[model samples]
Target: MFLECQNINFRYPNGSMDVFHDLSFQMKTPGFHALFGPSGVGKTSLARIIVGDFNDYSGVVRSEGMQNLLYSYNLERLPDWSSVGKHLEKITPPSLRDRKNELIASFDMAETMRLRFSQLSLGQQNRVNLIRYLLQDFHLLIMDESLANVDERTREKIILGIKDMFPDTYFLYISHNVIEVSKFCREILVFRNSLKAPQVITVNGQDHKLGQTVSKDKLEQTMLEIMHAS
Candidate 1:
C-alpha cells in the first residue's frame, strides 16, 4: 500500500462542526491520484493530516514505501530578493540541472526566468513555485490547486510533461476542474456531501499518459460519474 487512512474523524479546536467522520481510503499504487469534492469538505484538511501538518485528528494515516511527502499549494510564494532563474539554480541539485532546464522550456517559463519573483504574473508565479518543488527529491507530492491560474493549454502540457519526466513519483492532485481530473488522474477519490454515509467513492479515471488521447465518450462518462458522486 502507498497510503492508508482508516476511520479518520476530526474537528477544529473548539469548533462546532466535524471535518471528517469515519473517512477511510487507500492508495495501493504509485501514480497520479485526486481528491475531489465541493469546497470545505475537508480535502485540504485531510491532505494536511497526510503530510503530518495536523496530528490532532483521530485515525491512522500510514504510508509504506513513501518518504519525503511534500505539499505544494497555489498561494505559496518564492522569495523576491533574487531573479527566478537564480533562485531555481541555487536550490536545484547539481545533477538535476539538465532536467530543470528541460522543465523550464516545457513549462514555457524560459522567458520569465530572468525576472524577479514579484515581477511575474500570478500564473507564472505558481509555475515557478511548483518547479521548485519538482527539483527536490520526494516520494509523493500533494498539489493543492497548484496549477490554479495557468491557462488550460499550458497546464495540460505541463501536467503531461511532469507525468513523463517523473514517472516514479506519486501525485495527489486537487482541482475543481472536473474535465482535467477526469482526463488525467489515474484514480479519483470523490468525497460525498457532509453527514452522508460512505464519505468517499473511488472512481477509476482515464489515466491518460503522455502522448495518449482519451476518447470523448469515456471522458464524459468519468465526468458524469464524478459529478453524480459529489
Candidate 2:
C-alpha cells in the first residue's frame, strides 16, 4: 500500500468534540485521489495528521515514504513583500535547485518571477505555492483547497498540469468540486459521515463490488449519485 491508516481516533485538546473514530483505509496504487467532505469535518485535520503535523491522534498512519508535502487555503502566514525569486529559493531543495527555472517556465510563472510575494494576486500566490512543491519529491502530496482562490478554468489547467508534470507522485486533494474530482482523480474518498469509514469510488478501469470504472462523464454522474446518497 502506498498509504494506510488503521484504528484512527482523535479530538482537540480540552475540547468535547471527537474528530474521528476508528477511521481506516488503505491506498495501494499511486495516482490522484479526491477526499470530499463538508467543511470542518476533519478533512484538514486528517491531511495534517498524514503529514505528521498533529501527532495527538491515535492510529497507525503509514506511507511508502515518510516524506510528505502539504499546501492549504491559508496563506496569511506567507512572507509579505518578499521577491518571488527569493521566496522560491528558500523553499526549493538543493537537488532540485537547477530545475527552478524550468519549473517556473512550465507553470507560466516567468513573467512574474521578479515580482514580490505581496504584490501578486491571491490566485498568483497560490500558484507560486504549488510550483514550489513541484520541484521536490514526496511520497504523498496533500492539497487542502490550495487552489480555491483561483478561477475554475485556471484551477483545472493547473491541476491537469500537475498530474502531467508529476505522473508518479500520489496526491490527496480535498475539494467539493465534483467535476474536477471526476475528471482528475482515479479514486474518490467521500467522508459523508464523520464517524463512519469513507466510501470509496474508483475510476481506474478496475472492477469492484461497490462500483466499476467508467468514462469521466459517467464517473461524474456516479460520484454525484453516491455523494447525494451518502
Candidate 3:
C-alpha cells in the first residue's frame, strides 16, 4: 500500500455542512484516477484536501511508504514566464528533468519558449498548461479539468502524450463527461452529491456509463444524474 486515506471528513469553515465524509481510498501504483462529479459537488474540494491545502479535515491522509507522494499543477497562476522552459530547469532536479528539450519538441512548443506565456495562442497556452505537471517527478499527479479550456485537438494530443509518456505516473484526473472520462481511466469512481458523504461507484471496465453504488430504487436523485439528465 503506497497511499492511504481513511474516513476523511471536511466542511468549509464558514459552513457547517461537510464536503466529504467517511471516504476511504488506497492506491499502490501510477495510473489515471478520475474525480468526476457535477459542479459544486466537491471535486475541487477533494483536490484541495489531497494536496494538503485543506488541513481542517478529520482523519488521516498518509502515504506510509512514499514521502511527499503527491503533486498537482493547475491553470490558475501558471508559472508566469517570459521563458517557458525556465520552470523546467528551475523547479525540477537536473537528473530527472533532462527531458526538457524533448518535451519542448514533443509539445511543438520550442519556438514559443522565449516569449511570455501571454504571447502564446490559446492552444499553445493549453499545451504549456499541461507541461508544468508533466515536467515533474511526483508520485501522484492531479489535474483539475485541465483540458476543458483547450481545443479538442490539443486536448486529445495532450491526453495521448500523458498516457503514453507517463505510464508509471498516477493521474488524479477530473472531468464531468461520463462517457469521455472512461477512456482515460481503468477504474471509474463515481461521486453522487459529493458535498455530503456521497456514494462511490466502482466500475469494472472502461465503460462510460452513469454508474451508481446506491441502487436506483434505494436512493434519491443526486447531482450526478441531475447534471446529465439536464
Which structure among the candidates has the greatest TM-score? 1
Candidate 2: Cα lDDT at 211: 27
Residues 1-230 of candidate 1: C-alpha lDDT, one tens digit per residue: 48999999989899798888999999987888999998999889999999999999999998888879999999998888989999999999999999999999999999999899899999999999999999999999999999999999999999999899987788999999999999999989999865997899999899888878789999999999999888
Least well predicted 10-residue stretch by lDDT in candidate 1? 191-200
Decreasing lDDT order of the candidates = 1, 2, 3
Q: List the residue pairs that clash in candidate 2.
A: none
* Candidate 3 global lDDT: 0.63
Query: Model 2 misses residue 35 by how many Å?
Result: 1.4
Number of clashes recorded per candidate: 0, 0, 0
Q: Which is the better candidate, 1 or 2, if ranked by TM-score?
A: 1
lDDT of 2 by residue, 1-230 (tens): 38888877888999787788777777787777877767777778888888888999998988866465654553633576678888888888888876787677656778887888778888788778777767666767888777777888777667666666666778888887766676677676666555455433233311111123346567657566646645
- Listed per candidate, the RMSD to the true structure in angstroms reads 0.9, 4.6, 6.5
Per-model TM-score, in order, reads 0.98, 0.83, 0.77
Regions of model 2 farther than 4 Å from truth? 69-77, 94-98, 195-216
lDDT of 3 by residue, 198-230 (tens): 444544224122232333431222334434432
Whole-structure CA lDDT of model 1: 0.92
